[model samples]
Target: MSQRNRDAKRSAREALRAQRERDRARAKRKRTLTVAAGVVVVLGAAAGIGVAVADHGSSGGSDSAGRVIAPKGAIGKDSLVIPVGAADAPSTLTIYEDFRCPACDAFEKTFTPTIHSLEDSGAMRTEYHLVTLIDGNLGGSGSLNAANAAACAQDQDKFRPYHDVLYSNQPDEQDDKFADSTTLLTLAGKVPGLKTPAFTACVTGGTHKPWVKKSNDAFNAAGFNSTPTVLLNGKNIYSNASLTPDSLRQMVQAANKGKKPGTVTTAPSPS
Candidate 1:
């Protein structure tokens, strides 16, 4: 081959090698960026989960009596326990739940039937303690408004109905769903017999603030450190798969084996 040809061929080979190096570098940079982006996403997700866990730690909640019903539905200075059954029932179960807590929602949907069955049978009474576990940092403004609205509904004799709607239609704990007063009022309308004006007035006027505060205080007093904490018959119900319907029934049956005539069930298994 001529020297010029040889030199041209050599130059082409060099250029090709240079292009290949550039391509390799570009691919490495892309791979590095992809890995970095994935790490960031994983970190963000983990952070969100941690926030949820922290917020739910305080539902430390459920039912009870009219010993002192607040006038005009003001969250009365008097501590109100929203009861599920006759006050004289042998076992008094308390459920501590956060509106934003997904696990609490699960428990409400899953085990509520058992509670209802017991209450219908006059075997138990229940009290609910509402706590605001989710706050602004956790992507919620807390369940504070919802608690107040629910209390206002109680003033109109529709506490249970409003309560059901709140739990059933719980918004995303990580979003702005239940954050506004309008949404709160909208939810209040779902419960039968709820007096919208009074409830809204109570909530807007902060009338139920004390009641919600009192509930939180009471929950703290009761040693609540987590959401969905169940206290049955003055005993804490521990978390266990066996707390399900069949197992709970078995537990009730077992407890009643040789108990007094009025004692139909034992305390909810503590958590």
Candidate 2:
């Protein structure tokens, strides 16, 4: 072949090889991108499934016929809770309260009756976050003393009744006498099965001190600015002039409506 023709043919062959290499590189990049996108989609699906499973598992089972109650006596230093309704009843409510606050006392007297009835009827579950803000205000020892006593009561299974009576007999917020351990025991005596020396030992020895501290820690963690904060299914329930039995009931109903078999939304109660 002529030299010029040979050179031209060789150059054309090199160009074709280069083009083929470029094509293969492009295909490889496309495959890599496709696999990466698929991986992202799979990860997203896995995350969503994980969340759904968590929600389902947390809710437990269904209780269409009656209430299933779970009372966490004090979730924080200033929070108390009595969870009721079906474990699968579709809602969890939290009440952040102080033992010495008159407003909380009033709430106990006026609105809590309805709540207790609902608890009795299996409509909703309740939780109390017992806070000690009143202590600072009252020159009193705060809810800590009462919380310790209450935890002691829990050890003896007297928590619920003792709780009722404590709120029922709450003294002036400024007074320190009504909330001490001695008085708490005196008041606790009103509830049968609560006065055993065993229970007394727990209270005096501070057996349930950790539970009280847990409650206090949670209160600070939740960033609570005041006492008597009510959270329905993790949403704040206002307690001031805005609070009424009707309004509170509405929140309960709302909580129930959104509840699935095993999930809880934690919120603060309104001030």
Candidate 3:
């Protein structure tokens, strides 16, 4: 071949090589962009999942500390009242009691059986407003702790049994036995399924302490200065001099007379 022809062939080969290099570079840039877009999508999905989890935690009856807040329709901010009888019982009896109060223990001992009987018989339903009075009168977390644990028990539908047990096993008003979560758990063992990890976490972490304080605030706001205060049909029955455990049934019967058998006219009265 002539020298010029040979040079032309070499130039063509060089041009082909340059074109192949450009194609490879373009493919590499496309691959890099695809990988980057995939990373961005994955990161976006992870961030969205994080936000959903956080939203659920906040709105699902939990406080910022991950503690259970008061259940709906709870009286006075954080006080949980488990109704003992029919939902439509005519006469409503409200009891404001503290776990650490000796007076409350006496009141419970004297009236709990009768109250339960009345409740079972469908004559009346009782609303118990748990307070932490002894914690204020005495210097300790016993009342607050016990009340918190009791509120926690409500979450498990064991509030009534646990309430009875706490009153039955009341320590001295000043002993502060309820301050220890272990003692509360030991008591909870009496109720079936009450000693689970959730209950333990609630009691030990003082999850309901803020709720207990709110209850106490409600009690104070209601002008009650004592524990074991009882009200029947909006009347302060305990304030009456003739009130007795034996007379409680008669009072409920009288309150229901001429009124509907299952009509409660008032919300829970604070103690």
**For model 2, how many clashes?**
43
| Cα TM-score per model | 0.62, 0.61, 0.69
Q: Which candidate is the best by TM-score?
A: 3
Which residue runs does candidate 1 get wrong by more than 4 Å? 1-80, 136-139, 253-271
In candidate 1, position 143 carries an lDDT of: 73
- Candidate 1 vs candidate 2: the lDDT winner is 1
lDDT of 3 by residue, 1-271 (tens): 5786455445434433443344356446657967987787788788884312221111123576766577334553344565656677787898887898776676676677788777766678888787876665556778888888888887776777888889889987769999888999999988877789988888777766766666666776787656666899877776432455668888888877886655333322111
lDDT, candidate 3, at 260: 61
lDDT of 2 by residue, 139-216 (tens): 445466676676666655556678788887777655776545688778877887788997776556555444444565
Stretches of candidate 2 off by over 4 Å are: 1-86, 257-271
Model 3 residue runs over 4 Å out of place are 1-62, 65-68, 71-80, 258-271
Residue 45: error of model 1 in Å?
Answer: 41
Question: How close to the true structure is residue 203 of candidate 2, measured as C-alpha lDDT?
Answer: 57
lDDT of 1: 0.60
